[model samples]
Structure formats: C-alpha cells, structure tokens
Target chain A: MDPISLAFGLILDPYVLTVMVLAGSFGLFMGAIPGLSATMATALLVPVTFFMEPVPALAAIVTATAMAIFAGDIPGALLRIPGTPASAAYTNEAHTMTMNGKAEMALGLSLTGAILGGLFGSAVLATSAPVLADIALRFSSFEYFWLACMGLTCAAFVSSGTAVKGFVSLLLGLFIATIGIDPMSGHPRFTFGNVDLMGGIQFIPAMIGMFAFAEVIRSVTATTPHFRPPQERIGNIFKGLGPVLMRYKVNLLRGSVIGTAVGALPGAGSDIAAWISYAVGKKFSKEPEKFGTGHPEGIVDAGSSNNAGLGGSWVPALVFGIPGDSITAIVIGVLYMKGMNPGPTVFLYQPELIYAVFLSFFLANLMLLPLGLTAIKSSKRLLLVPREILMPIILLFCIVGTFAINNTVFDVGVMLVLGLIAYLMEENGFPIAPAILGLVLGPLLEDSFITSMIKADGDLLAFFDRPIAAALGVVTILIWIVPLVVRLRRRGRLPEGVG
Target chain B: MKVNDAVPGAILIVFAAGVFQQTLGFPPMPGQDYGSRLFPQVIAGLMTLCGLSLIATGIANRHSEPLFVPAEWMRSPPHFVNFLLLVGLLIFYILVAGWLGFIPTAFIILTLLMTRLRGRGHLISTLAIAAVASLVMQQFFGQLLRVPLPWGIVPPVYW
Candidate 1:
C-alpha cells in the first residue's frame, strides 16, 4: 500500500498498457493530420475515457497528448502544413529543412528533442508539484484574482499579432463565458430563454468548433491543391540527428527549462512556450540569419520546448486546480469528474494516483520515440489519403464527437454556430488561442474577482493588501503597462534612432 | 470574402453596445455591491475601446496593398456556391438528424459533400466510405458508449 507499489500496480496493469498503446496510435493519427490538433484528439477521447478507471483514464489523456505533440511535426516536415498550433511555431523551419533534402534529419530532431524535453518536464512536475500545491493551498480569492489576471495578460501579449487584436479576441471569449447563470446570484445572465444556454456553452463542443470545424471550412474553401505527396523517402530518421543534437546541446537544454517554466505559469501553454523559445533561440544563435532557411537550430529549441510544456502545464493544474492552458483546463474538468479534485489536499489524500499520473508522463514520452519514428516513416502514405475524402470524414467525427459529449444535438448546433464565428474571426486576423484561454480562465477570473470584492466590503484597495497578491498585481500591471511605455518612448526618439 | 478591417471593428462596436445595454437591465443583488452586470459592463467598455482602435488602424492603412488583397476562392462563383451548400447541408443535418437517424444523416451529408468537393466521379467510393463509417460509428457510440443515437427508420441491429 506504499506510494511506489501502488503507482507501479496501477501503471503496469495489462489494461492500462493496452489503453496507452491505443491512445498513442490515436494521437499519432490525429497529430499527423494537418487540420487535426492535440486538443481535438483529447476532446475525441473524452467519451471513451468516461468508461475507464481513474488511472487508465488519466493515462489515456497523458499518452495521447504527449504523442500528439510529437507527431504534429510529421506533417510539418513532410508538407508545409502544421498539424497543431504548437508545431506551427517551427513549421516554416521544419518545411524548409524538408525542401533542403533533410526530411529524415528534421523529423529525427523533432522526435529526439521532444522525448528529452518531455522527460525533463515530467521530472520537474514529479519533484515540485507537492511543494507548489502547499504554497497554493495558502492562497485566497485575492491572490487567485491576480494570478488569473497575470495569465490573461500573458496570453494576450505573447501572441504574434497585434496586442489589441489579441485582447479583443480574449474579450470575446470572456463574453462567451458569461453566457450562462451567474455563479454569484444563480441568475441567468445571457441565456435569452434557451434552457440549454443555462448550462453555458459546452467547452468540448466550442473547442471542436473553433479548432477543427474552422480548419475544415478553411481547407474546403481553398483554391490551391495541397495533396501532392513528397517524392523523398524518409529512411533512418536517426541517421543524421546526432550531429544536430550535439551542435545544439545547450539550446535544447535552455529551451526545455524555459518551456517548463512557462508551462508551469497559469496562463501560458505549449504553443506560447514554443514561440518564445524559438524567438529567443534565434536571438541568441550565432547564425541567426540561417533561421527560417532550413536551419535546425530553432527547431531543436522550439520543438523541445513545445513537448516539454505538456508536462509543465500539469504543475498548476495538479497544485491548485487552476489550468495552465486549454489542455489542462480540460484535464481539470476530467479530474473533477473522476472525484480527484486537484489541490494540496489531493496530494495527501490521493498520493498514489498523483504519482501514477506523473509516471504516465514519463512512459508516454518514452513511447513517443518508436511511435513518432513510425509515423514519420509512413508520412508519405498518410499524406496521400486525399483531402477530398479525408475532410468529410473529419467533419463526421466533429459532429458525432460534439454530440457524444452530452448526447444532445443542441451541442452540434452550438458547434456549427461557433465554427462560423471562429472562421470569420480568423479571417479577420484575430487570434483564436487567446479566446480559448479566455473561455477556460473566464469563470476562474470572475469567481475570484467577485469573491475578492465581497471580502473587501467593496473596497478595491483590499486586493493588494496581501504581500503575494501585491507582488502578483505588480507583475500583472507591469506586463500590461511597460510595453505601452516603451512604445511611447520609441515614438519620441524615432528620428534620432534613425539618424 | 475579405473585407476591410473596419468591418469587424464596426460589428464589434455594435455587439458591445447591445451587450452593455443588456447588462444595465440586471437587478442588483442584495448585500452585494458588485452584481452580475459589473464584470460584463467592464468587458463591454474595453471592447468598445478595442473596436475603436481597430477602426482607426484600418482607416489609416486603407490604401495599403495588403488591405485590398484578393478574397481567394470567393472570386470563383462555383466554389463559393459549393461552400454555401456545404454550410446549408450541415444545418440540414442538425435539423433532421434525429428523424433521419445519425447513421443515414451523416452518411448522406458526407457523400454529398465529397461528391460536390471532388466532382461526381467518385460517388460509389464515397458512398461506401460513408455507409461503412456511419455504421461503425453507430455501433461504437450506440452499443458501446450507451449513447442513444436515434435509430429512426432502420431496423435495430445490436451488433
């Protein structure tokens, strides 16, 4: 009945191993497809996990997500299309490497780096989650408000597009989040007499609509053909990977550390971690100009960071029940459903379960090596599946997947409506990820804000009374204000700088 | 079709106005200084500012080549028609899916979409794919997951 033995017994069961392999294959399929994503893969698995035990259920998600993040690079290397947003950060560099006749090397680099980063992140989670959870157990509504604010700001500012557009997308998500009954008063806010709306928008359906449905529409509407399979055969993916790994050893380690830290943050996730690491990698590289020109340096850093972030994201979710990103948001919901509410108390009550979850991260990443290489070897065949036939099947999955969530056709309608809106939003250059982050964090933000207000007797200054809250508030304010200050300062000295 | 950036901004402004007005109608809670309307109103206020900024930016760059970029497939009338038809088909499935049953409904839509998107030559192949896929999914969800996907006109097959 010790923690180690319990963890081993849960993980080593034949049923658990079978689920891991099956989920790993499913994740590979979803991640290797250009229009599918890791989030969608998780969403699709939710119904299946409903029938599983707690450990197997958690294993299903953990294995699928880790494999999906790595398999995303397969399409990016074979074709220019990125399979997931996390892979999108280095898609151009990966494709350029393929065009340069190093497809094997490119895929190998992604596979090896992802495995290393995931292992490193899992180690961090195993060591620090209990300690972090203890600290988080001391937090009140005021501290939570600042934490959520910090997360929202990070998501908005870290986007690659204009800050205002990102913020607008975020606001739209918050608005959507407000559509159900107000938690404070038990009064409906924006349901408009539809009984289904009282439950608010379903997260799984909305996510499927935004990520999968929008992509389907985009792919169907495109005039250009993208189905041409690459002529180059990928053989011995690990052949030339050693030199690249040796050359960029420090970058890989740096990216893993940076990625894990960012993933541990409440708002930031794998995509943001990949983007920042790629930018930083380019900034610090000796041959920065070689980037985006088939260079493996950035891929070594960003690719590793993206997968490492999968483990890192679990930190906050396990510690405080606050999701680190959209994936963890879904995980938190599942954890609650399984009667394993996340917090410092859970570490004491369900120590074996928590340790088993952490152990699954290790197994999933180690499994990524063989599964990822197999996916890469067969990438050409996967590409030839023909979008004309493939797209409709994906559409079918979306409809059924959305319906499976609640066994109601109402969710299907919601999916279509959100899909149309998301398509338009993306067309207008508004980023969707921040909006997703908004939806996931919106309730948390509102609950904490309202609770803090009530606790303070309507005094806003009380939000800063606690030392940790004050520090978090200061950091959040700086994240928002400093960028504006710097922009204003640059405008005044533009002529002098140019001269 | 691609529109001026100002179009989205203008739409957002109207949306924010409507939401802000609705928030004003919520009754205040007893003993609570901040009601349900407060957070929504704050969001509306920020949205208004963002919309205005987008409008200004769009107008400032109205003459840029990027702003006038082609709307891609929308310029082709047939492609646009097919896109609308697909959207309509999805709505149709949502409405009649219960009566027609999930398997038949999904199968029909998938066949029509594939034929329209790829031209009509692969109808038989598309039909087989749709039929087999729908049946497999029906068994998986209905029998395995215990989800009651409407059986409708088809005879019950446990397997």
Candidate 2:
C-alpha cells in the first residue's frame, strides 16, 4: 500500500512500463507543440484508456499528464505561445530569456526545475495521503460546504481583475448553476420540466465550451498576436543545466513549495500556483528589478510551481474526493466510475493501486527531464505550422471534443453560446476566468451548503458549528476583507463615492 | 463601462421578489419557516444587492474611461454583429438538428459559418472542414463511445 509496493507494481508489468514511456513521450511531444494542450491530450486519450485495465491505464495517464505539464515549459521558453495556460506562469520571463539569446539555458533550467518540483510533490503525496485521507474522512457536510466556499473564494480572488468584478462573475456562475434540480428536496428549481434539463448541465460540455470554444472564438475574432523573432540562435536543449541549477537554487526550492501549496487548494489550480510562486520568488530575490525581461529565477519558480501542482492536485482528490484542478477533476471522475470510490475507504480498499499511482507520479517527474529536453530541442519547427491551417484544425478539435461529450448537438450549441458570451465579457471590462471558476465550483458550493443546513434541522449556524468549517469561513471572509483593507490603506481614502 | 449595469440590477430585483413570494406557501410553523425556496431567495437578494452596487459603480465610473478594453469596441460593430450572428446560427442548429440529423445540420451550419466568417474565396477549407468533421465525429462518437449519434428524418449519412 506504500511507495515500495507501487514501484513493484510498475516493474511487474512490462506492458505497463512500455506504455508509460510511450505515453510520456507522446504527452511531451503533444504538449511541446505551441497550440496543443494537456486537457485535450487527456480528453482524446480517455476513450483509449477505457479499453485498458483501470490500474495500468491510470498509471499511463498519470505519467502522461505530468509529461505534458512539463512539456508546456518548452513552448513557453522557445516560442512564447505557452503550450497551455499553466505555462503562462513563466511565459514573459522565459520568452524574454530566448530574446536575450539564452533559450537553451532557459529551457534547461525550467526542465530541471519541473522534474525536481514533480519529485517533491510526489514525495508529499506518497507520505501524506493516508493522513490527509484520515482527516478528510472526519469532514461532515458542513465541512464540505466550507471547503467548497474556500475553493471558490480562492479562485475568485486569484482572477486577474478588480475583486468586485471577479465576485460578480462568480455570482453569475452560481446563477447558471441554479438552473437544475435541488438535491435536498428533489424539487427542480429552474428546469421548467424540459426533459433535456433533467440531468442538469454536464460538466464535460461546459468545460469544453468554456476553455476550448471560448478560446477559439477569441482567437478567430481578435487579430492574431505574433511573437517577435527570438534574438538567440538557440543551441543545445540541455545546454548549461548545471550552473543555472546552482544559480537559482533558492528560487527553485521556494517555487516548488509554493506550487505544492496552491495546487493542494481546490480551484486555485495550476495557473495560480505558477503565478504565485513566480511573484513570491521575485519578491524575495536579491535583484527584484530585473524580473520581467530574461530572468532564470522567474522561469525556475514558475516552472517548478506548475509542475509541482501535478502531485499536489492528487492529494485532495485521493483524500477528499475533491479535485484541485481541471485535469484532476477528470481523473477523479474516471477513478470513481472505474469502481474505486475515492475517499478514506479508497486507502483501505485499494492501497496498492493508490500507491502505484503515487509511485508513477514520481517516475513521471523523473521522466520529464529526458522528455522535456527532446521537446525543447524540437519546438522551433512547431512555430512554423502556418497559423491559418493550424487555427482551422484546432477549431475542428474543439467542435468534435465538445460534441462528443454529450452526443447532443444542444451541448455544442451551449458551447458556441458560451463562447460568444465569453468574447463579449472579455471585450467588456468583465473577466471571464471568474466565470469559469464559478461554473466549475458553483454546484459543489450550493449542494453542500444546502445539505449541511438540512442535516442540521434548518439551522444556518451549522456551517459555523464545526471547528474546521468555522476556520474556513473565517478565512474566506478574511480573503475578501484583507484585500479591501489593504487597497484602502494604500490609497488612504476611498476613491469618490465608492462606499 | 457602458454595459448597462442597471439591467442586471432590475432583473435580480425581480427574481428576488419572485423567489421571496414562494416563501409564502410555507406555513408559519417553526421548522418550516425558511422552506425550500429560502436559500435561493437569499442568493437572489444578495445578487440584487450586488447588482445595485454594480449599477452605482458603473454610473460613478461612467465619466471615467473604461479600465480594461477601452472605448474602441464601438469602433468595430460589424465584428460584434458577426459574433452575434454566429450565436444565432448555433441556436438554430441546436433547435432543428434532432429532426434533421447530424450531417445535414452540421454541414449546413459549418458551411454557412465558414463562408460568412472567413470570407467567400476559401471554398476548399469550408467544404473540406465541414465534410471531414461530420465523418470523423460520426465514426468516433457513434462507433467508438456507443453514444448512438442521433439520426434524423433523413436517411443514414454513410450506411
């Protein structure tokens, strides 16, 4: 049930080992492509995994996801496109290094940092999951409601805009979430009795719509922003991995720690993890002013944080039946439907399988070094795919991906409608990230809160009765109020008729 | 800044009122006081409050410049209209696709959208993309996932 048994499980199966390497390589290659994404890679492969034994298939996916996440650093460093949004962490910093004629070193440092971060995360997952699961098992409905609130509050606050707008957007998400069945009473709130509405909005379609379609719509409508040609004739992929390691040692360590923390927080996800790590690293650095241009510190911190998020996300999922990121959310669904209900009982029921997945994470992180090196070396050609052709193919993928989820053209319609909504919201001052967060977390918050209240015989204070729930409530309120206090203190007075 | 924040406020106010009215159906008994509509009504009240706040903020910020995107949005109304038209097309496709089947509905929508959005001369991209999408999705979703893609009044697409 521990790391040793898990490692042995991988060794016992030659096919699983072979599959792991190939999947890792494939993930690295796909994620290295500037336009390709980890979510799509997983989505496309989920069907393939359906035919395989759950244990080995899960190992393959775990390895591939890590590789893909690490591979994202390649595109960010070489092409400045950020192969995925999580790569947005080190994007400006890493690409700036490429412009400054140090692309090879930049890629090498981040690749190394990603592996190290992944290892750190895996170590934490290996050691702490049982205890975490025990703690999670103690949670009541009240605790779950508080946790959901915390997750949403973290995501909403992390959104890159005025906090008020973020809250409003989150409110909009909660509003949309209300358009379905009420769990406690079994009374449908906003379905209006349409049979199609009976099942509520499927998460897969909504996710595909928000991330894939909305992004594509934004891409086609807006002027295609081009990156400046890299100033450096980039050399070897692993060039100068040694000195860059020694140079940003502190930054790398701090970033990995920050990444693991943020990733453990449900809904904050990978993007926030990387950004927070990079910001903290830069804040604490000896030379803070030289950050935006071409700083290895920035790349290491961001890259480490994002990669570390891989394992951190699993902690919550394995322990609490809660997903910390989008990919983890999908993984949780697959795990449950595979006949392994993930909770404290999962630890007791299937210890070896859980350990095997954890060990696979460790191996995957180690594999990232070689896979990421190949990706960095080969990323230059990806930028030359001709945008017009590439855009159409991506659009097609979005269409198929969105449609395949529900097999309903209605979902595709929803995707397009959401895309248009996303575009307008982007055009106007409103931030769309909060809307995504709201959509993802809204149902969890509503169901848990209502269930907890009902269990407590209509007492609203039940949420605060539990010590954990009370602490989370205090933290959520503090998350809102502290920022407001800081802004007012900084400005010395409220700007005009604000209050 | 010109997004008519008052509209959302009015909508929230009305929703809140509607939800609060449902609370009347519950007896004045102690445990039944809040009722099933209680939480939603509370959320609606919160939404109204926030919506009103937004209205007040929008008005205060009206004279000032838009913070994020700026005032150049009206500079390209046609582009916006194209997006709206795209949304409209999707709505029509969804409403009618069940009756017409996947291929015809998808092909029609895709071809029209490709022509309208990308311009008239890319005939090859339009046809190729439309046709290819139908075939691949049909095979993958219908054959692979076993979700049974909806067939319409028309004959089998390929069988």
Tell how far residue A184 is off in model 2, in angstroms.
2.2
DockQ (model 2, Cα): 0.28
Interface RMSD of 1: 1.4
- Local distance difference test, each candidate: 0.86, 0.70
Candidate 1 chain A: worst-modelled 10 consecutive residues by lDDT: A152-161
Model number with the top TM-score: 1
lDDT of 2 by residue, A1-499 (tens): 5646665765458888887888887687657766567765665455455556777778777888888887887768777778777898788888888788887777878778889988988888888898887787778878777776776676566666655566766676666666566565566665666766766676556655665566555544554455543334557756667787788888878888888888888666677888898889888988999999798888888888888888898888788766676677667656764788766788877787787788788778877777666666666664554444444445545555566655767667667766666655555556665565566556667667666766887788877887988997888779868987897787776565476
Interface RMSD of 2: 4.0
Q: How many Å off is the CA of A234 in candidate 2?
A: 4.7
Per-residue C-alpha lDDT of model 2 across residues B20-115, encoded as one tens digit per residue:
565444333245434446556666776677677766766776656343333342346755555555566667666876788766766776776667
Worst 10 residues of 2 chain A by lDDT: A223-232
Q: List A-chain TM-scores for all predictions.
A: 0.91, 0.85
| Residue A372 accuracy (lDDT) in model 1 | 81
Fraction of native contacts in model 2?
0.22
